[model samples]
Target: MNQSFELTPNRLRELRGFAIAARLLNFSRAAHEAGCTPSVLSRRIAALEEAVGGKLFLRTTRRVTLTPRGEQLLAHCERLDAVMLAMAAELRPQGGEPAGRLCVHLPGAYGRLCVAPVLARFLAGHPQIRIEAVYDDAYVDLVAGRIDLALRVGRLADSQLVARQVGSMRRYLCAAPSYLAAAPALHDPAELKAHRCVAFSGLRTGTLWQFSQGRRRRSVRIDPVLSCNDSMATREALLAGVGIGIQGDYMADPLVAAGQLARVLPEWELSTSPIQLVWLPGADRAPALRALIDFLSSEL
Candidate 1:
């Protein structure tokens, strides 16, 4: 035969009683406010104290005050209550917009030119969502850093993250007219070997330059005295007549347009890298993320 058992409402009732007692500070007043007798309220508070194995309140003849632990617990309970209320508000669904913090990571140049404008437009549309944008060239660990999404360029390394191809980008070999005039005339890919090469040197092979013409592809190795990891620094060095450097159109576009830098080897098939927006699978599909991606796709 199964024995009959009833679940206890002791804990929740006790907490309710404690909440009242803490607010009112007087047992009689708390009892009246909680719709229970003073004796019942006292017993409930005692049971709550016993169940938690800690005295939550210090009582005097005239007043009742919370202990340090009780204060901390009260603060936490207040926060929990606030969150519950917010959740309820969200559940109401009165044509409300998505509102929360959005964190994004992007490569440096693209962040400034491409992502920044998209972000600006997104922010304009959804004034509720707060944005935190981080720009860097180094590959950031999205999972470890809790990044909502990343705008990654070029060939992606093997990873578990899902990616959406937003657009394409190409690198170009360019030099200032002054430098091209002062330096030896580069007529062919073979002549690049004789010219001073300003290398970004992030890759393993520093001097190796790849070029293609129709079906013919050639890689020429040269010596570069100036090498740096920072792309902006490399661009500046190229501008300062350090040497001819190959960089992406994102960086080279303004300079090329201004005639500060001229695109070389237009006939040669140059290496091109794709611009992709990447995010982890099973991550929060926030409206902010969707809005950002849509804005970028439309703009870029």
Candidate 2:
């Protein structure tokens, strides 16, 4: 009869391989992280499953997701890894400042002017940290796309995602000097019906221009002569004297300054949109994520 439990090399290797694979959720990514190939990683997972007599993954060509049992095992693995890392850091002679890869998503306009400056200084201060910035207007799925942080505009939907208000932006009604010269004098939002209005299709307002006067707010529907999905295109149309336009302040500021576009109804403020920095709730603990938030909050 055996008195002591024998250590098995196959079981130990499988345990390590499974933990890494589970953490990444992609065989190719896990293999790359482990300095191996996907084929080898797949074989390791298969061997691990055979040893445990249970399947750990459900494979598909397009996506790799965690199974019920895999999620449970992943939690345990994460805890164990955290404990080990903590122990290692405590035992090490000197572990200086926080450092890691921070993935951030930003709008194209804000990223160029606002985010870039802050990131430059942040990188200089924290030499060890790497920033991955994704700038786009399209919707991104954070968890599935592996995004660490995102910058958003306008009202936010009620959700589990954590948000921090960075600043506010306003929309302005503008037209070229030449175009406004020939058009009828605009006194109110209702007058937009007579003037040719250039529309950006992305704006949620349904062919309706909303404005505010003192404490009163009103929405007036209009028939725009031209429409485009992008602000850049709309700006071009306005430059060509196609029609008047409603656009964001940041995009309008330069044109307004250059006298290419004139802001109409400046005294009356319309809708004000808020800028926000959004991230997954639990990602606060991640060093890179925290660093980015701190940098942006201070700079923006």
Predictions in order: lDDT: 0.75, 0.76
Mind sharing the TM-score for model 2? Answer: 0.65
Backbone clash tally (model 1): 0
Instruction: List the candidates' TM-scores in order.
Output: 0.65, 0.65
**Tens digits of per-residue lDDT for model 2 on 215-283?**
878787878888886667788899999988887887889889999999987866768889888886446
Specify the poorest-scoring 10-residue window by lDDT in model 2.
1-10
The per-residue C-alpha lDDT of model 1 at residue 44 equals: 77
Candidate 1 clash pair list = none
lDDT by residue (35-85, candidate 1, tens digit) is: 567887788777766655678899888778998766765675567557756
What's the alpha carbon RMSD for model 2? 11.6
Alpha-carbon shift of residue 210 in model 1 (angstroms): 1.4
lDDT of 2: 0.76
CA RMSD per model (angstroms): 18.6, 11.6
